[model samples]
Target chain A: MKNKFIYLNNEEKISSNQNKPFVYLDNGATTKVDEETANIIKNNIVEEYGNPSSIYEFGLNSFHNIENVRNLIKKKINAEKEDNLIFNSGATESNNFAIFGMAELGLKNNKKKLITTKIEHGSIKAPSKQLQKKGFEIVYLNVDSEGFIDFDQLEKELDENVFLVSIIHANHEVGTIQNIEKIGKLCRKKNVFFHIDAAQSFTKVEIDVKKQNIDLLSLNSHKIHGPKGIGALYVRKGIDLKKIIFGGPQENNLRSGTENIPGIIGFGKATEIGFDKNEEKVKEMKELRDYFIEKVLEIPNSHLNGSKDDKRLCNNINITFDFIEGEALLMYLNMKGIYISTGSACSSRSLEPSDILISMGRSYEQAHGSVRFTLSKYTTKEELEYTFTCLKESVENLRKLSPLTPK
Target chain B: MTLEYTKKVIEHFTNPKNVGEIDNPSGHAIEGSPACGDMVNIDIKVDDKGIIEDVKFKSYGCASNIATASVATELAKGKTIEQAKNINWKDVEKELEGLPQVKVHCSVLAVNTLKKAIENYEETIGIKKEAKSIEEKAYDELKNVVNPNTGNMLVDDKLIKEVSIKEKKIILKIDLSDEDLYKNNINDEIKEHLEHLFDVIEIIFIK
Candidate 1:
């Protein structure tokens, strides 16, 4: 059967004769929006163009659509009680709001310490560092070689001074899923606010805020086959987060800006689809992941970077070759049309090796030679075969020039 | 010739030449920079005319680095000191087809090793000259100077193999057996009392 996602690429072709199959394995960066979600975004912008803030009949209809999407997302995540869901540009802005806003609110009380992991994405790490420069003491919990945090150290570090604990639910590099439930419980006991950067993990992994004892969560729509430039921050009921941007009191006074109505609606619909299809998708992805992992191991000196167990995200398979540069491998594979990521796409330009791998006790050399292959439900066996073929040749070509390799 | 090397540097890297080391050699020098893993040691046998008749090298580093070393050795063999010293990195890269921007440093390592080997040879020559001058001076000064009790000059009593001079101090390398010395008055006798005898100063024990 032809892949629906590949078929979407055909529809993307401007002319009928220009269609070509492009296997996209970089879904961890961002996914191609599904047809339904894309249609919803197009219709909302082109036809339903009423300003949500306006009180006229047409404006009221648009406002209702916005509320409907908000409520739909609220129900999808099982956010009990009337929790405030504020829409933002993306997870970066949402993360900024959660950390900086919370820090701002807690400043008067002298609760200034922020606890987070060493392997968090730049969106979380950047704002946390900014907070640190502004007099907030930041404690970074170290992750093990498998990219899981040391809970013993975390328990010791959590104390009265910590105002917040912000961590990514799943690592973007190695796909190690953090134990958010235990972390959430620990935060609750310490009375410290816990914020999850669920950009990569939100729709892929199941999350229940109340069950996990989560206080705040940041999510991005583009990561889950929805429109870009739209994301939400789930602020638990009774939590007081100060506004960072000022102008108008929209999003229940939590976020003050003109709401991105169409993007939010698309985000909500995408979340709904994800929640419904996550089970089947996870099963299919696990099968494809196992196949890819098994085949990749046949290559000499090839090893998986993350956990082999179910604790890892089913879609992610980060591999390290003994004597190859990640950039060279990525470029060679790209020439073959097998798209993949060397690390987080945002930080790929730095070429400084994976911070997540370094945190996991991988040597700088190992981290530099790492490549991340994240799969989606749309990925097929044929794509994996083609990727494997290209990868074998690329690694061989790169290793031929490496001085570290033995004859 | 143009100063810039040709693109052949990359080709040499892709197809490296003369990879391993030779068995035995007359002179050998190993140099490494801990900052980077660039290491090269060359062993050579030069003819009376100062031509490098035979050269062998072992390099542990990047491809460009190793290739540069191999190419540098090949280029240095038939050339005189003047020509070898004038050898530029561009020539090494020209020997190889081309090199990527990052791997250009490998070629630099090769060039640096070539310069180091020449410096090592010159340093060896200086050491030899200094040693010969020091021996001549010591032989003239200590010819008749004797141990007070044994009535023998310290140099006449033993064979010296090596001598090193630093600042105002002289260190003599000698091979001696304990049975060659008589126990009685060994410390207070000849060598001990010679301190007051002449300008030939400080004797040391060696094995």
Candidate 2:
């Protein structure tokens, strides 16, 4: 059921169920594009096909439309007028630009240290390692058993040599929402640049760059019902980041490739529409997520990862079942047509367990058994019930067949 | 669309053949770890001519573990002890078409358990190695038989009160209620299985 494209005229509406019936719970991995966003992308491809770089009437119109979309995104995030949004392929590129680019800028200023947490996404973690190999000291702040960042450790690591402190606003795997406002204020006080990877939290949570005092923020479209391959990195007026890719002066010479016009327009439309229903969407997500968790925990020897008392992304639920492997569980769920993810989608293929869980002091057994269920605005109660039934049956069968008895 | 596993692998995995164990098995071995999500146990009954009369396996893992073990038992059954010992994991992988690169260890688990069971068989009748006392052999075999419902061995369940072997006859005193879910056919299955393992005239299962 992958890579199946449908061509629809303006009169014909796009439906998600056209291809097949599936209970998709991997919204944290990526969300399904809404009808409005799909229509915008289609119209952009069919009617507004002009290259914005060219000097013509259509090109000028394209350029104007792009600016309008950018403005719409700017308004959605409630950023200051001085802030600039640099579009990129997605959060990975934005994170690279934030981490690697800042590391280079830090090196120029004789600040050879970068600060981050062990629970940051691989996009940030990998770039941090790259910087580490280049002789820059990368300090990974520890998280408690509940996946909460140690503010004391952050305070101890902050020094004049520390140029950038990059943290994720909402972790992709465990769904723990960090205290970015406090972290931002601390970074501002320490005169260190703060970058927040808001890929999972952008549209789900309220974020104001000025109010949060965040210097650099990474936002992606696909995680918010927008089209894929389009994201934005919000940079404050005073902070200057070196370009990772060299090209023409597009995106203020930071990201210099031809813009993804259709994706950008779809992102704008998705954001605008998503914002219109933000409160209602959050309520629905919380209800579904809570109901699912309550039922899932009723299974014996199942435990939730990360903090339950603190704030988490409304749609994310991560749980670990003792004596069962996450990959096996995922396969069983996949066979049942209930598509969910295990651990981080990026690292699930690897034999290694989730680093995020390991960093939170969970044992390898716990980390290996972790499964993530991320609901979306489109997810319904019927889907949740179906997923629950399939999950229970799969777990019972797997455990019965498993050699590892519960301790 | 089909998954990466072969049709044979999927078939064996989904509806595994000869699952569970042989009571008072002539040869038995447990290998791999459920922590790493791959564990298999093989039990074999050897005939007087040193040929594998019957083989069964129980595995706790993904499709690869279950399929590899199922196919391994099929390859070893009815083969001579020497021939079964020579059946390597690569042969099992080949018989199942193939396993994923990461799941190659599952084939290894199947082959190791099969060989270990053959080794245990050889030691039981003083064929190729030193033989343990009959009581020790019976204890080891019974200790390895895991309960499919609870995943614990019978010894861990504290169900067996007495185990005695006289000549070629083995008697087991299992403490359980008739209303137990595993009660129906419990005595008949154990009697049939142990009779093959010891080459005995009969087995008495006393409750």
Candidate 3:
């Protein structure tokens, strides 16, 4: 059967006879929404235009749609309870709430320590810094060169005064999936709060809140091919989280704002579709990823940043090319109609080395020279072949100009 | 045809001249900003006639910095104490082809180090009178000048530690640790301030 999963732009198909558009390799930055999910969003915007907060029948209809979507996500992730899911702007906001809310809770209980790792995204690091300034003792757990957190060090750092352990499910830069289930079990045994920023791995991996013992989980819709500007935080029942933003009573008086009904519906649909397609997609992506890795290894001085065999996300591949700047290589690839991200998209312009890689014991130079390639369900073997060709050419061209490379 | 820099200047950058230290030279001058990571040290030898016969520099920075040091040495070689004082950054930049706009200050570090070497050379020759004259000249011009960025007088701004005029080029060596001067727009401010005083100005930040 013809693969219906191949990505094609409707606008391009209608306007031109081009066989292929740009090969987008920057799925880690943001994936294009599936056609079905896109249709749901489009239909909501076009027809269901009423605000969910309004008192009219149309508003009621939108409100019911919001609840249905929430329920769907609740069922998909198997959250402890339906009310535990609280919607926010995106994963950044959800992360902020998780960190700040936990800190505030700790403050109320006279606990002043927060435990986290050095490799977390800036969304976690920035808030952790804020908490440190606010008089909370912050302990940053270190990671090894392969981006694996030292669980022994974590155990030593955990104490009675420690408030929360916030970590990313899988690193966005190097694609190292942390043992959240093991970490969660430890946290539960210690009676400590655990929060996972699952933005990169939420839909890609199976996450059972109870199985993992996750107290709080943050997820972004955009990462799963849902609408942007919509995400949710799962705050376990009986956990008292202090509200960061105070306004009109909504979201059980936790997050107060006019609900984004259409985006929420799209997020819900994406979540449902993601869980359904995950098993088959995972098998396919792993095959493609392994093949891509095999081809990439042929290039000299190119190295994988994370573990080759483990519980890594099937779609993520982070490789570092010695003697070449990642940003320059990315720009060259973009000119050739291949899109990929170098390090965190949020901090790409800052020229700062990846914190995740640094914590993993990589030098600043190695961290700066790394590029991430994240695939989606729609990614095909043909695209992978084209990507390898473009990458080989780009690396050679970049090395020619690099001062560090010898002739 | 690209640019005709002195062969010595390009040679020093490619295979630098007088690399490392001199096992306790008569005098040592170390200068550069940590923010910029540009540093230079110069050592000199003087003969009985109070003429500078030898000059060597150990520089840590970009390509322009090494070229500047090599050119400064060529300009200072065999020059009497009186003649070396007139060497300026413009002369160095001109001698070493032309530095990129962002790296013009590399030339300044070379000029600054040469001035420090001269000071040490004069002291070594026991010419106390000439040393005072050189100090007086540097002190006079730098005293009234203000760092344009901070709007504070150069002497009062505390960023500048020493200033010398050599060959119509004024070299101002600054201390980067002086918070009020090197923070934010201060570099641009100081550059603009120095432009109005002399036809060619060079600044060396000594952290």
In the range A290-349, model 3's lDDT, one tens digit per residue, is 889889979999888887655677888888787665654665565456778776221121
User: What C-alpha lDDT do the candidate models reach, one value each?
Assistant: 0.71, 0.78, 0.72
Error of 3 at B140 (Å): 23
* Per-residue alpha-carbon lDDT of candidate 2 for residues A142-174, written as tens digits (9 for 90 to 100): 999878899999999999999899999998998
Interface RMSD of each: 20.3, 13.7, 15.5
Model 1 chain A, poorest ten-residue lDDT window?
A1-10
The TM-scores of all predictions, comma-separated, are: 0.69, 0.81, 0.68
The window of 10 residues in a row where model 2 chain A has the poorest summed lDDT is: A2-11
Quote model 2's TM-score.
0.81
- The sequence of per-residue lDDT tens digits that candidate 3 reaches over residues B32-128 is 4322234567777666686876767765444455667767877887888789889977787677655543345567557877777676666665755
Error of 2 at A118 (Å): 1.2
Report how closely model 1 matches the true complex, as a DockQ value: 0.02
List per-candidate RMSD values in Å.
17.7, 14.4, 12.2
Regions of candidate 1 where Cα sits further than 4 Å from its true position: A1-21, A344-353, B1-207
What is the Cα root-mean-square deviation between model 2 and the actual structure?
Answer: 14.4
Winner on TM-score (1 vs 3)? 1
- Who is ahead in TM-score, 1 or 2? 2
